[model samples]
Target: EIEAVAASNRVEVKPIVMCRVTQVYETGACVYVYYGVNFFGVDDPLQLFFSIEQACVEVMLRHGAALSHHHGIGKHRKKWLPHVISTPSLRMIQGIKHAIDPTNVFATNNIIDT
Candidate 1:
């Protein structure tokens, strides 16, 4: 999927390292896939990253992969959070935040809204 996206966008996928593993803990089953790509002669770094991430996300969703593997939800990826986290779960998170940081002193645009 990464290769396909790179080809379609005329970008390069130079993965310096690739790793895949699955483990089951008391919490749940987890799948980890990590890779690093080298973008060659990139003119627009922002657009390139967004395009590649979007493509990878779509492919992952199609293949039943979680929206995020290690990275937590942030501003840029908040749009996709709804696809992964349920409404009740989000509300619960917000509630927990409020309980701990009632003033929202540590809140940022990237963190989930209350």
Candidate 2:
């Protein structure tokens, strides 16, 4: 069992790095790392890494656990069909992308303006 240390009135928390392995990678415009420390359903047999931006976004939106252990929203996993470009924040993002790219080279879905 782990012992607790006390302060004025609250117990001081000590961080424990409960991990086995970690690796890092870098690509065109991004760098990513994989931590092999995990629990059930996270069948990470190999410690791997990817530096692709698309891959990073893909994993986060798809496999990586979210607020309530939900799936993805991209072409791979979640595959959500966004009919409407809802919200002012999203509109702002579209506007910004259009302002920068304007040619729609990195165009995918949802953000049609880009």
Candidate 3:
């Protein structure tokens, strides 16, 4: 799905799967996906990168995969946090952030929009 998304945007990606960190469960296994893209001739590579990343996330969510495995969410994935978390839970997180950093001086907009 990720490769197809990249291909649709005219970008060829080389995917490297590392099963060493995979977690086995009663139902199935979770494999980590890492890929590299060649942006030698692409204009606005950053935009293209974001487009592919967002598309991949959407595909993963559609297939019942977590938004992230080990790597936590950052500004790039924050927008999708609501999809995985309940609204009240999200509000609680925001409240916690406010309590800890009322002035919003620490990692503003890193996870939730606090």
Candidate 4:
């Protein structure tokens, strides 16, 4: 599904599966996908990367996959946090961030806006 999404956007990706990092459960399994995109002849490579990544994330979410696993959600994925976490939960996280770093000194804009 992720590969299809990337291809639909005219992006070519080489996906490598990290089997050792995969987690298995009775209900389902979580596999880590490490992919490299070919940006040859692209004008705005960064924008293209973001577009493919966002589309892949949406596909994962639609298929009942978590927003993130061991890897934390950084600024790149913060915009979609609300879709995975509840409103109150997001508020609690923001409040915690405000409490710890009132001036937004630590990892500014890494996760939540606060």
Ranking by TM-score: 3, 4, 1, 2
Query: TM-score for all predictions?
Result: 0.68, 0.27, 0.76, 0.74
Q: Model 4 — TM-score against the truth?
A: 0.74
Q: What is the alpha-carbon lDDT of model 2 when measured against the actual structure?
A: 0.36
Tell me the spans in candidate 3 whose CA falls farther than 4 Å from its real position. Answer: 12-20, 25-30, 112-114
Per residue, candidate 2 scores C-alpha lDDT tens digits across 12-99 of 4431323222333362222233322222232331221121223444454474322112232343322222322246765687688788
Comparing 1 and 3 on lDDT, the stronger one = 3
lDDT of 4 by residue, 1-114 (tens): 545645655665553333344778898777765666676655677876787688778877797778677777877888888888899998998889888998999979875565
Residue 114, candidate 2: how far off, in angstroms?
7.9
- Give the TM-score comparing model 1 with the true structure, all chains together: 0.68
- The pairs that clash in candidate 1 are none
* Model 4: number of backbone collisions: 0
Sorted by lDDT (best first), the order is 3, 4, 1, 2
lDDT of 1 by residue, 65-98 (tens): 6765567656777777767778899889878877
